[model samples]
Structure formats: C-alpha cells, structure tokens
Target: MGSIATRGDSKRSGNQGMIKTHSRSRHKRAQALAEMAVMVPFLVIGMMGMLDLGRAFYYQISLTNAVREAARYGAQPYYTGLSPACNAIPPATSPGASCPVPGDQNIKDRLAQELSGTGFVVDPTKIQILPDQGTRVSNCGTSGSCQYALKVTATYQFTFITPIIGDLIGNPLTLKTSSLFRTEY
Candidate 1:
C-alpha cells in the first residue's frame, strides 16, 4: 500500500519526494534469463564428466577383481594366488617342456570371459602376461631359479551422457589394470 498522500496542510509533506511509481526493465530480466540458459549446459557437462570418472573408477576396480580371479586360477597351477599377478607368474617348473597350460593367453581369456559374464565389456586381447614373457633373468642354471610375472591389461569403452566431450574425444575411455606377484608353486 502506498503511503498517505500529503494534503496541502500536511506537516510531513517534505518526505513525499521519496515515493515513486513501480517500474520493470524487460532488458534486465531478459539478460538474466539468457545468462542462466548459457551457464546451464556447462554446469551439466561438468556434472556428467564427474559421473563418467566415477564409472571409470568402478570399472577399474571390477576389472582388478576379474583379473585376480583369472590369475588365481592360472597361478601355482592352482587357485588362491597373489595381488600383483607377477607373484602368480607360473614358475619355470618344467624348464620349457611345453608348458602344460601353454601360454598365459588362457589367463587373459578367462579373465575377459568372467568379466563379460559379470556384465563388463573389456578388450582381453590387450591383456599382457609377463609369465609367458619368458624369464626375467637370462641363463638361469636351475628351473626354479628364474622369476616370471602375469600381467592382465584391459581396455574398456565408456559411454558419456553429455556430448561436450564426444567430438573432442573420439571413442570411449580406456582403463587398464595390472597385478604382479610371485608364483606359489
């Protein structure tokens, strides 16, 4: 409600100067709306990027578990193995008599299959087993003297919600995990 208008004889007539009619600027309101619209996409993209990173981290963890399972199976010619897959590297038990398990490819394939069964898509071909990489030490006199490693490297494709990075980064993201441990056998 507006203040009481001053009468010719009003004592407070001097204060009337402060009162004014209400006015709204369309330009200012439009500018504010435009600014909000412009900032929203950037804010959304940032949030999506954060979400993508979290997914990547989770994938890495699951991939690690998958590799562990495969490595455990491949190690010691038995189960229950090491964290760093290298520890599980099949020892030169037979000294190159055509390994019973053949090469470490079986380990990588098993891991990929398990991961896929668990609803994870990964490239198993990227897996690298140091066990088949041959002995690290050259000219070993004894069969058990040399140490080997089993490495499982996996690459994954990540889908993004925001197109902000889609054009810039072709294809999905790549995540790799590897473990190395000594063979129990």
Candidate 2:
C-alpha cells in the first residue's frame, strides 16, 4: 500500500509541473506580442525614411541634367554670335523669361520645359539668373567670347508615413543647379 501511494504522488507531481510550464509559456507569448507591437512603428519609420531618401536622390540627378542641358543650349553662338547649337535665349533686355519673341524667355525656360517632360515638376519662376537672364548681346557687340548662363531650381514635398516629429513637414526638399559656359560669340 505504501508503494502504491508513492507512485500516485509521483504522477500527480508530474502533472502539476506540466501545468506550471504551460502557464509560463503563456506569459512568454504575451511578452513577445507586446514587444512586436512596440517595434512595428520604428520599422515603418525606417522604411519611409529610405523611400524619401531615394526620391530625393532621383530629383537631384534630374536637376543636375537640366542644368547641363541649359548650359549646352546657352553655349551656342547663333543668337548673339553664340554658336548655332546654343539653345533658345531671350534678348539682352530680359534675363528670365523663356520666350521674348514667341516671345523668347531665357535659356533656362526652355531647359526647364525639356526636363519637366521627363516626369519632374520644374518651375522657372523659382529660379534666378545673375547679371543677365534674358539679355544676349548681338553677334557684333563687344561682349567678347560670349557666355551663356542657365540656372534651375526644383522643390519636392515629402509626406511621412509615420511622422515621429510632426512639425517639420512643411520644409520641402530643394535643389539648385547652375551652368555657365563661354561659347562662340
């Protein structure tokens, strides 16, 4: 009878230990769930930041190419003793307008148009030309070797998926590019 009693007690103790193990497992599962919920937002923010950075990089590249094109167009001497390859530019009176005759504005306007066609939004009004944006000396003027200038500015607004610091949303991404060249004038 004593041996039988001891065997029964051992079986009960084994079952009790199993019950405790199950309770501890349940607690662990709840902790893991809580941790996951807390970490989700940080993961989302990191992904959004990466996306924003990629867009910024793409816009910067587009701005750089726009400036290069504008400079190339300005380098021509056809209008003011500039090379024929020079892109369209306005007279020596206006420095910013794209069309002065149609009317011709400045070399920058034409370049902006071309670039915007490539899926980027560009506004010439946001840009400033130094010395003369619309003014181009004639082929006979003493302006010497002839120089063409083009400046471009682009801005992009990025919306956050999870704004950790919400107040800074109004600040946009800004890019500026300028091109200056001395072509045949």
* The best candidate in terms of lDDT: 1
TM-score of model number 1: 0.56
lDDT of 1 by residue, 59-150 (tens): 77888888777766555443223223433444454433322332476676778777875567666567766645344333334556443454
For model 2 the local lDDT of residue 149 reads 41
lDDT of 1 at 27: 61
Candidate 1 lDDT score at position 163 = 69
Model 1, residue 139: C-alpha shift (Å):
13
Per-residue lDDT of model 2, residues 144-164, tens digit only: 333444233334443434454
Looking at candidate 1, the ten consecutive residues that score lowest on lDDT are: 15-24
Give model 1's clash tally.
14
- Residue 84, candidate 2: how far off, in angstroms? 11
For candidate 2, the lDDT comes to: 0.56
Off by over 4 Å in 1: 1-22, 25-30, 79-106, 113-118, 133-147, 167-170
